[model samples]
Target: MQGLMQDWPLTVDKILDHAKAWHGGREIVSRSVEGPIVRTTYAEIHERAKRVSNALLGLGILPGDRVATLAWNTGRHIEAWYGIMGMGAVCHTLNPRLFAEQLVYIINHADDRIIITDLTFVPVLASIRDQIPGVKHIIVLSDEAHLDGSLPGALAYETLVENASADISWGGFDENTAAGLCYTSGTTGNPKGVLYSHRSNFLHTLVTMGSDVLGIKATDTVLPVVPMFHANAWGLTFSAPAVGAKLVMPGPKLDGASVHELLETEGVTFSAAVPTVWQMLLTHLRTSKGTLSTLKRVVIGGSAVPEAIVRGFRDEYGVDVTHAWGMTETSPLGTQATPNYAISQMDAEQQLQFKLKQGRAPLGIELKLVDDDDKPLPHDGTTFGRLKVAGPFVVGEYFRAEGGKILDQDGFFDTGDVATLDEHGVMQITDRAKDVIKSGGEWISSIEIENIAAGHPKAELAAVIGVVHPKWDERPLLLVKLKTGEAATKDEFLQFLDGKIAKWWMPDDVVFVDEIPLGATGKIDKKLIRERMKDYVLPPAAGVASGAVALAAPPEPKIYAPEPEPEPVVEPGHEDDAWLHWTPDAAQSVDRSRREAPAAPADHVEAPADAQLPFRGR
Candidate 1:
């Protein structure tokens, strides 16, 4: 028998309604793209959002219609987001940093009718306006004063909203209605859309607000340096409003000075951004001798958080750095590195070591690792395998079914990340599946070496890629982008990693580049790095010219034949039905050092018969 409960639909509109009702006086400050600091409260934003809905309705936007926004993180962007999502319309966010051709492709693929953009992106949008035939109206997120009449027939956002009525109703439809659409970075091929539902978004916000995850409270001030177009700014858009937290939008000025100015001026307590942004901020702080007194905690993701970044923030600024991990597929919040009980008990060095890992999966998410043949790997913290995740917010299929059958038969989506899950539920990403180096039939994590190299003071950015070697088939080649006015030789860097990693895992040669190529998401573009270094000739020490260097070949990993795929099981009230079962035998006591490359553990603990247990959050 099912327990009776109220049937209140979990729509995105309720979040704003609740915020307006209770925290109406809370400030939502923004550094506008028009060169001014704009301040508005929840009550005012709520009213404006309603007007946005009415304006969209007047513009002929209907339920499930796609309304795109190619604007920065600002007050107007927030209003447009809620207005579109609350009115049963899909808010498709366009990343301005993407290539013009890519933006054109995504806008056309999404079939967005009306696009609301900031003045900064007007030129970019106007150039491709003719290419996107589906786009009916271009609503500039500025007043008539800023309008230079560059694009013909463009409407001003203020005029449209000011003319609309605020009495429009919201949330009469089902909670499962599509609310947002975000395209992937398309690093490999064409980008695929990840259509999010109101249910999934609302649930993700709830889970993020939990103490184990982001733990954003009403008293905290959040600065999302990450763009709203990038996976919903890592879900800060929903979680901040849901908890009545004050939001400080950085707008388009994401430079170290601008971000630091806003953080100091606005008294921001908590922030989330990629590692590159933080690196810039740290550089600015050090050069300017500035202090971050107001900033308390920061969540760093998008790429792995370098050890130097964590130490810089923690030791220098006295700020806690939480290394997070996610992708476009898992509502972009698969795991957060908040200290658990066991990790908190460790000493300072050990704690930093634990914090360096990607941390554990929070509640509402399940994680597992598998081998080449899809066989489950033990959670011994040593055996690295392919990472997979299943959750309510995880995408079962891409938008419009672009990539057919994304999820495995057992309901877990392969993340294309190589990772290791510890016994305490912590997960550490070693390398991307395509980026892992295969040397002498053994795998070497390029990411692991890159992280170590990046920690060096001389290195501004580092990337590791596998280059063909005569004896080992493949060997890691280190690429370094030295900091400004910093100089380092290949021998110096190799000496830094002498005792840090295994001798066999050492890079063959080091090459210095002026700048490292970063993708649209601020991640090191290894694919592009490979292309740039495709014809690069390794030094003689790499054994490319002569097979003089003799290295011992590691034992080949066990290969298992593919097994029959299991069918997905979906049951009512049983969220763990989609989770892979892990028995007690799967637990192994192995002290694995993730920092240094070490030999694989000798003993293996095989998983026993599948005994499913109810999913629990640590």
Candidate 2:
């Protein structure tokens, strides 16, 4: 027997309808491109989104066509988001930070028919105009005054919407149809697209609204410092409205002072950003000594959250920091930092330790760890293993690539991260599978070393890579970008790592650089470092004690060559025989005086069919 409840599918229209009906008076604030805060209500926004949709239809946009947006987080951007999605046209948010060539490639590849962008990006788009063949209609999200004379045949955003009828009907369509498309950060290669369906987006929003995840509520004011181009801003776009929460969008200025001013003025209760932004905010707060009394909590992710950042927020500012973990394919949020009842009253430091973990899997998302042979790893958090995840929001395949062939046979997506889950079910990331240091027979987590090094007072940023060491197969080389006006002795920094890690995990040497290279997606670029330090030679142990200088050409090791015939693919429940090769380097010796590297014994843990991998450092 079916229940009497309505079986209507959850779509952007439904979310907007609910927001307009129940929370019509709630504020949706944004900083206009001209530099002032404008406050509007959800009811007004609902009407404008409908008008924008009608305008799209007027311009001959059919369902499933890609509509590109190159605007910042503002009222107009939000309208464009819902307008395209509501019409069943996939909204492709283009990152302005990407290179001109990449921008041209993505726009042309997606066959974007209409592009809604701000005036600021006009210059860049103009430079690559002739290259983008798919883009036909360009709508500037500003008035004529802001428009430059060089932009030919572009319609103003207001002019298009003002004449559009607000009564455009949303013809029924399957919720499984595509609604949005977000490209990866392209750290290693050209960016791949993650196509999100309406069903996936709707489910992701419900999970985000849970009390354990973002816990969005109508009374809360959310400011997503993460850009819309980044995994749909961790899927907060829908979560904010699904729960009727007030949203404050900061336009272009994301600096500490500007962001802080917006947070204070808007009375923002919750916000989310990466560690770098929080660090800058913490520094500004320390210098200004101003209190963020209204700010209640901050969700830090995209990168690992330092202990100092967590402690500073809780102890100093009275704001709880939730260290979340997810990826572009996971609808951006897989794990939250909320603790269970048992650990709620634990000591502040102990609770922080628990909070530091990747928390637990959000509702409807499953996490598990697996070995090289596809066997399940335990949740003991001691055994580190590769992380695999699957959920409603998780992408099964890349858009327009290989005809949906990205998933393994078991339907799990490899997150490319190595991690372990503790007894408390909190996931701790060790390193990326490609970056995990293999010394002798053990794996050394470079993230642990980098995190510790970053905690040092003098260190601004740190990256640990397995450089060519003649003795231990591979030894860690520390690359540091020091804080301005801070002085740190190499010996002192080494001493700081003494008790925190194993002696074998100690870096062979510390190299100072003007700046640590960062990828387009804001993560540290270890690939560049490995290339720059390709010819570096390690100092002999005997030379360290004698202060004698002896430089020699680095030994060339045998490179592993793959067989012409590929190995057979193993199904999830099947086992295949494969041999892994390991050899120790002969030139570098482990510094016993240094700290011992911590073992990720949990790397060996595995999960069930729908299990998630306990990986970290995403």
Candidate 3:
């Protein structure tokens, strides 16, 4: 017999409603695209959001219709989000960083009806207006006076909402109704939408609030430097209000100076963003000797965090750094590196080693590693396998079934990541399955090499890609974007890694480039890199790595070879792509006789600028 429990649906609107009633004075400070900071309380946001719903309804928006938002993180943008989702409409967040063609494709594919965007993106929407005929209204998130007449027939978001009435009801539908749509960065072939249900999003919000998860508290002041379009700002939009935490939304400038200014002036206690933003911030801090006096904690994601970053934040700034790992498909918060009780008791340095790995699954999620043939693999910490995730918040299938039947019979979704989970349940991502370099029947982790190379003092940003080799099938190629005004020879870098990594894992060449372009999600554009370096060929196996200049003709390939081992059991995984279509080089015949030489163990945006809107609790 079923127990008697309240049948209250877990709609997202309840989070806002509860915030309005209990924490009505909680602030949502925003750096506006127009200059000044806009401060609005949860109570005001609640009322204005209701007005947004009425305005959308008057414009022919119905429940289940798709309303797209292409704007930066701000109070108005959040209002638009709640306004759209509160009325049972799907809020589709469009990444402005994406190409115009991609925007066209996504808007057309999702059949987005209304485009609510910031003034910054008005030109972008205007350029693609003809391509996306499905978008009926262009609601500019600004006052009516700010209209420059660039985009004809555009509605001012402020005036539209101000003219509407808030006497309307919300949430009379099922909790499982679709609430938000976020497309993947499309690192592979095409961007696929991950449709989230109100039930799943609500449950995910609750999961993120756990002590071992985001650990966001009502007393915390949050600065979500990660864009709102990025996996719903990693689900902070809902959880902040759910827990009554104050939010600070950075407008459009994500440069180092602006972010540092906001962190200092606004008294931000906690913040989250990708590694690139932190790098820029750390650079600015080092140059200017800036400080994050009020900032206590930080969440780093989007890509692997460099060792220098963790050290810079924790060692220099006296801040806590938590490495987060997740994908759009998992409501964006699969696992965070927050140490559990057992690991947390250790000293700071000792705990950092554990913190570097993606922490164990939270209460609701389960993680497992599997080999080829879908067989279970051991969690021995050293062995790498395809990572699979099973959780309530993870996506069951992509929208429109672009990649059909992704989930296994047991209901686990393949994360396309190669990882190692230790006996203590700590998960460390080694590389993408498709990006792993296969040489002589064995796999080499480019991420491992890239991380080591990035630790160099002169190195700023680093990437490792496999290139065709005559004997070993595929060998690694190192690409470095050196820190400004810093220079180092190829010999210094290779010598730095001589004792720290396996000799066989060393790159065949090191190309120093002026810049490394980040993808829409701030990840290394490996696809673009491969395209740019497609014509580059590896030097002879016996010679030293080919740097920008030869530097010197070092010793031949006399590195010691380890004992021959059997090949790892791995299958060809989902396409490893970023931004553009890339054809991976096929593995050649393995020369099993040659073993890899092992060596000693080694160590190791779109937010606003001055756009730093500070926040304080009432």
The whole-model lDDT of each prediction reads 0.79, 0.73, 0.78
Question: For candidate 3, what is the lDDT?
Answer: 0.78
Candidates 1 and 3: which is better by TM-score? 3
Whole-model lDDT for model 1 versus the true structure?
Answer: 0.79
* Pairs that clash in candidate 3: 187-577, 253-608, 253-609
lDDT (10s digit) by residue, model 3, range 125-232: 887799999889999999989999999999999899989999889898999999999887676778898899999999999998987888999999999988778888
**How accurate locally is residue 582 in candidate 3, as Cα lDDT from 0 to 100?**
22
Evaluated with TM-score, which candidate comes out highest? Answer: 3
Residue-pair clashes per prediction, in order, are 0, 37, 3
- lDDT over C-alpha atoms for residue 81 of model 1: 94
RMSD of 1: 15.0
lDDT of 1 by residue, 1-618 (tens): 987998888899999999999999999999888888999998999999999999999999999999999888898999999999999999998866566777889999999999999988788777888899999999999999989988888999999999999998899889899999988777667889989899999998998898888889999999988778877888888899888999999886777888899999999999988777888889999999999979998988877878999999999999999888888787778888777898888899988987888888888899989999999999998898999999999888988789799888799999888989888888888888899998999889898899899999888878899999888889998877677676566777788888988899899987765445565666776776676567766677542321111011111211111122233332344333211111221111121112232122110111000000000000
Model 2, span 161-199: residue lDDT tens: 888888977637888989998776555566678889888
What's the TM for model 2? 0.86
| Candidate 2 vs candidate 3, TM-score winner | 3
Ranking by TM-score: 3, 1, 2
Error of 2 at 237 (Å): 1.5
Ranking of candidates on lDDT, top first: 1, 3, 2
